[model samples]
Target: METLVKLFKNNIRQYGMIIALVVIMILFEMITGGLLLKPINITNLILQNSYILVLAIGMVLVIITGHIDLSVGSIAAFVGAVAAIMMVDLHWHPVVAVIASLVVGALIGAWQGFWVAYVKIPAFIVTLAGMLLFRGLTMIVLKGQSIAPFPNGFQKISSGFIPDFGSAGTNIVAVLAGILFTVIYIVNELRDRRAQKKYNFEVVSGGLFILKLVVIAAIINAFTFMLAIYAGLPNILILLLVLIIIYSFVMNKTVMGRHIYALGGNEKAADLSGVKTKKVTFWVFVNMGVLAAISGLIFAARLNAATPRAGTNFELDAIAASFIGGASATGGIGTVFGAIIGGLVMGVLNNGMSLIGLGVDWQQGIKGLVLLAAVAFDIYNKKKVTFLK
Candidate 1:
């Protein structure tokens, strides 16, 4: 019993958000008469949460380093406007428009990064100013109007799905790809476990490992199966998948990842240890900016147009998701998966509430309480650990 308790205590930080996710799913599932997990709604939940999940992954890194970006929502809105104007108003090709928007976003990130990392400005002030400045720029670019009905090819970025085996031209290819992905995932997990064992580190039990594999396989099959059901996997889904994999790799398996953890753990000590603190901080913001641009493009393509208010309140959702996913408000802690789960929880709440006809007011109230509870938990846990030590 004592061993079990210690194990639970050790994993609480990592698994706490997951527990919250399960609890939220169960609660909303019961309240909504099972609408939360209904097939169509479940699919929609994934789609709605996808962008924020992407943002949260990047945000996790930024927060871990003890900073925040408030301008992402505004940047997304502005970039979407730019893409729309370039495609519709200027007759630029969708491809070119995308490239242009991304460059602009990177530049925006660099600009802010310079201010924060070099000029020694507080993140809150810089980002707060950025929020207002970029939002106003979006209005100027969009002329207080929404532009849409983009070229079909661009529209497909958001609305198009991958073709599957059932389709005349694409089913076999997709099936093979899915199988390959499963194999790769299993191999990687087993390899990582072996490495941990080599270093005499305590890996999770093989039983737990197999359980994870089974659960992952089921999830992948279910996901691909749904795409195969209606319009195969989306082109954007593929893009998002590639991005997630790349970012996850960079975060977990690179020197860049090490630097980020070092900075988050202790900025001054990290600087003294030659981690290039300013450069890392600058790059982190730049990365966030690029991600915001990518998010804007995806959203715009999906809508087949651009709206002036495309990303309003998005920053709030992303920030909340990170915090709820177990990121410390004071920084030095967070993870990609945690942020994803956090975003999904919010998505579920929105979808479930909407499906069950819960008023928007109540939904907001519940979310507020949930956020408060999460932060309170963080503080209480910190205090408990300090006392224990």
Candidate 2:
């Protein structure tokens, strides 16, 4: 019992956010007359937030390195505009346009990264400049016009659903996928426990571990079931899942990932320990740029148009998701899963508020308050831990 209590206390930041998400979801479901999680609405929820979630994944890495990217929104807009020009005006194939856009994003990242990593400029100043520069470029590319009606192939990237193989309106694939995910999760947890025991590291109590597994399994199955009932699965959701798995593996199991954390934790010490801080910083921004480009493409595909104001305020949303997901302001903390939860929290809020007929003005204010509260809670928790120590 004491061990369980200690575990809960230690992980309050992680677990609290999840509990808050569930409570908020339930509250919204009730208030919205059961519209919040309806099949179609659930599908829309994933589609609407997919881009922000992509941004959140990249943003978490940036914040983990004790830096920020104020330019992702602009970069995404710029890339989307470039893609529009290539695909629509130039008549380039969708695949070629996508490749070109991602390349452009990388070059842009390299440009800003050179300043931040090698020139020793503050990331804040560099990214802020990038934000303005890219937004201006987006305007120039679009020439104050919206580019629309993308090729059918491109639209499918964001709007298409997985084909169902089962008859009678049943989505067997989604159900199987959910079961597979749960089994894999349980296996991983047990394996991790064994490894920890082998290395003489502390492990969670068996009962607590089992309870955790059950809760997570239930959530996963429930989510998949909802999607199965609606449209099986979305293509964008599949992309998001793949990215999450890859990034979670990178952060947890790779040497570079450890270096990043160390660099954020103590740059000078990490450098002294032979970590390539400059290279790490450079690559992180480069990676962020690539992700932003992908996000831009996804957003563009969803709308089937590229507009001048496509990514307005996107930076704020991504940043809020990262911080609200339990990322420390000082860096060297946070998880990919946490970032997803944070993005979902914001997504649900936006969706629920819209259903309740809240105006954009009220929505913005409420979101601002939520972001502020999340950061305040993080600060308070950090201080409390320091005091206890």
Candidate 3:
């Protein structure tokens, strides 16, 4: 029992939020007559929140580096508008338009990064200026009008499903994918455990380890079953998975990731230790811009339109997600997986509230309260840790 408590305390940031997510899901499942977890609604939840989730991924990185970006929403909007004009008005190929949009996003990132990193401007002020600048640019580009009916191939970025390679009451592709992923996950976990043991690191008890593997495997299989029953897997889901895997690897197994954390943890100390603080900070913002652009493209693809209001308040959602996912306000503490989980929690909340027929205003209020609670919890945990020390 003491060991369990110790474990919980050590991993409270992760376990706490995961438990909260599960509890919230179960509560909503009961209240909404299981509508919250319906396959179609689940798919819609993924579709609706994918862009915000993408932003959260980038936002978490920015926050970890002890900075904020108020410009991502506008960046998304601007890029979407630009892409629309390229594809619809200029008759540019969809692929070319996407590539161009991403490039534009990178340039925007570079602009902001230059100000923050080289000019030593506070990220808040630089991004705030960018927010207004890009938003106005979005309106100017669209001339305050919305563009629509994107080419089918372009729209597929958000709405397309994976191809069905097997038939099991419509398709077995998702199920197969689920099984494959589960196997990979288990193997990885075991390999990690073996490596830890070989290095004489403390390892969880075998029983506890098995329990975690089982629970995670069950979740993966169940989620994939739901997808298999409905639309196989979304193309956007694939994109998200790829991004998560890539980002997670970068964060966990790469030098740049260490530099980011080091810079965030203590910029002065990192610089003293010979870290390229300016270059790292600059690249982080550039990455954020590229992600924001991708998000914009996805949003535009999903709606089949690019509007002046396309990315309104997206930065807020992403920031909220990053915080709720256990990012420390002071920086140097977060994970790509945590950001994803936080986004899912918000997605589920939105879906559940809408299913229960709640008004948008109420939904916003509830979400704000949830975000506050999450931050409060983080602070409380920090205080406890400090007191213990």
Candidate 4:
């Protein structure tokens, strides 16, 4: 009983945001008259939120490193414009255009990183200037007009669905993927538990572990089944999954990842310990630029156009997602999965409210409240922990 209690408390502290997400989803699902989880709506939700998820992934890293980038929205807009020009007007190959856009993104990152990391300019000021500069450049690039109707190849990046090879009315690929994911998840959990035990670290009891596995498996299979029924997997979904897996591994298992956390936790102490704070900070922004660019391409492809106002306020969305996902504003705290959950929380709220005929004004107001509550919760938890210690 004591072990179970301890496990529950630990899991709550670590996964409270995820639990809140699930609860909010269920509430919205009920309020939406069963429309929230319909197969088509589920697909729409994933597509609509894919670009934000991309940005959130990168933003979490920035927050984890104890900095902020207010220019991501502008950068995304600029990159999208560049892509549109390269592919539409210049007639560059889709593949080559993508490469060029990514290169542009990296250069943008390096530019801001130079100011932030090397020149010792505050990130807030640098990114603020970048926001204005890039937004202006986007307008100039597009000449205050929208570019449209990208090639089919480019559109497919955001709108394509996976081929279905299953029997009529079923998606065999999705089911298989779900099963594989469940197995991998269980195996990883068990392996982690064994490793922790070997190192004499605390671990949940066997029964609790089994329960956790079962619950997660059910959720995974259910989500996959919903997707299978609608249109199988989306191309953007695949991209999001790959990124989540790769970044999760990087953040949780890599030496660079640990160093980033250390840097965020205490910059001066990290420097004293021989951590290259400047290089890490520089690379972190560079990575953020690349992600913002990828998001730009995805967004432009989804809209089939690049407008001057493309990516307006996207930085706010990404930042909110990070904080809602349990990323500490003080840095050195967050997870890739948490960011995904945070994005989903916001996505579902938007979808559900829209379905129920809520106006955009109300939606924005509600979202603002939710963001405040999440940050307040984080601060409360931190204070409680400190008091207890």
> TM-score for every candidate vs. truth?
0.93, 0.98, 0.98, 0.97
Candidate 4: residue 6 Cα off by (Å): 3.4
Q: 1-389, model 4: which lDDT tens digit per residue?
A: 79777665654534777878888888988988798989999999988999999999999999999999999999999999999999999999999999999999999999999999999999999999999999999999999999987999999999998888878787888888899999999999989999999999987778878888999999999999999887788999999999999999998899889889998999999999999999999999999999999999999999999999999989999999998998999998988888888898899888989988999999999999999988898898888879989
- Which is the winner by TM-score between candidate 1 and candidate 4? 4
Once fitted onto the true fold, the runs of candidate 4 whose alpha carbons sit more than 4 angstroms away are 8-14
lDDT of each: 0.81, 0.93, 0.94, 0.92
Q: What's the residue-level lDDT of 327 in candidate 1? A: 82
Residues 250-332 of candidate 3: C-alpha lDDT, one tens digit per residue: 99999999999999999999999999999999999999999999999999999999999989999999999999998989999
Query: Which regions of candidate 2 deviate over 4 angstroms?
Result: none
For model 3, the local distance difference test gives 0.94
Clashes of each: 6, 0, 0, 0
Residue pairs with colliding backbones in model 2 are none
Candidate with top TM-score is 3
lDDT of each residue in 242-326, candidate 1, tens digit only:
8778876787889998899889889999999999999999999999999989888877876776887888888888888888888
Residue 29 of candidate 1: its Cα lDDT?
85
Using lDDT, give the best candidate's number.
3
Worst 10 residues of 3 by lDDT: 165-174
